[model samples]
Target: MKKSFKLFLFTLLFAYQFSAGQNQKKIDHQTLTWIRYYNVLPLTEKWALHSEFDNRSFVNPIHENLFVIRIQGRYRTSKIIELGGGFAYFNVNTQNPDADPDYSIPEYRTQQDITFINDIAKITFHNRFQLEERFIQKADKNGLLDEFSFAYRFRYRLQSTFTLWEKEQNSLKGTISDEILFNYGKDNKRNTFDQNRIYAALRYHFTPNLGLELGYLKNFQRRASGVDFYDRDIIRFTVYHRINRKF
Candidate 1:
């Protein structure tokens, strides 16, 4: 069963990549490097809080910074189904010798997710639908970029996790996941940016709900409505924890 599952995951990933290549754009060499930290906190029986911080640097001589914050809640509907929603805030700033002195923009977003569990593995499907109205006070005054407008975007994701080996003390687990994003609407009418990502991960669990994961992430993106693609190879570390409460 374990071998079959692994084979299935490999086949699916290969198919997805092959299909994506047919529509891929020209490659870009610029890169962005970042470190992220995430924490999950329980508030009540069916509520939770999550937060993350990221520090990123662009390889381009002109480096920029991006920051985001989010808060969310989860509700359990049945043994196989869970629902969640959240709001997020985003800010971006750029510093370049050729550009103006400084620039900044802020935005907001909301999202939801559903999950299913089976003996073979657990699956989670989620979507993040966002509306961002950019505010560029300083940059606009300098006539560097447009002032403000609304952009609509959404991300669709599917993820699965399976236990490979289980013993009294520890277990080995495997995960496969994919996400695709679409951006559109008035401010982004040009369909400026989009992203597709796929990943495979392995975990070592000390307990049923606690584990450490090591993973490889393959990400592809299209930027600014041009026929240019950016590909990134990422190494990720993840930690998992779950808690139950009765009300």
Candidate 2:
């Protein structure tokens, strides 16, 4: 399964590169900071609730970029497989940080995912595949809200983590992850390859239930025009918390 999944991802990536062609792509470069919080609450041995809050901001002039909230229910079917479904809300600003007044665009998304976990030689790998239904509020030339546009997105992420140092329950670890996204539906006109994200982080665990991560992420995205792209560098700080209980 892992080999097949890797082959599929490589094929998709090849297609994206081939489609890019020789056209001189216009790129917009920007720097941003992201703050995030993640929580996991166990309802039972096999059921859990996961929640996330994220805030993003532009760096140079200090402007808000995006805000997001997500909630999901996860069920562990076995030691190595989990299934999850979730809802997410997003408030986004213009991708151009230099816009006179940053307008807010709202989006609602519902998604489902399956995750496979593997442990080999003390390194743990997670492979996650997800599908999303997105409803984005459109805007007119004057930035007035219009009817919503619907789209479907598919995402695949591969992540790996290994212990860097360990003493009792407190430890430090390094993580690397990559996610690729593709878009489909009537609303997606020019591009099927939406974006790709690459991230690396150092995480510190204070206890079994709490941890902190500092990471850097690079996002490369193709716009609706297909000729325009965004290259974003982001600094991210995250807090992870877990609560275990039964009701």
Give TM per candidate: 0.67, 0.91
In model 2, pairs of residues that clash are none
Relative to the true structure, candidate 2 reaches a TM of: 0.91
**Ten-residue stretch with the least lDDT total in model 2:** 14-23
Residues 1-247, model 1: lDDT tens digits: 4543454466457547744764655675544555455566677765677666555445455465456676667676765566677776766664222343455655556666665433443433322223333333224545345444555566555566676898996999887777666776654555454677777889897986567777877777665554566666656666665444345
Q: What clash pairs does model 1 have?
A: none
Task: Give a tens-digit lDDT track for model 2, residues 64-95.
Answer: 88899999999999999999999999998866
Where does the lowest 10-residue lDDT sum fall in candidate 1?
A: 124-133
RMSD of 1: 5.6
C-alpha local distance difference test of each model: 0.59, 0.87
For every candidate in turn, the CA RMSD to the true structure comes to: 5.6, 2.5
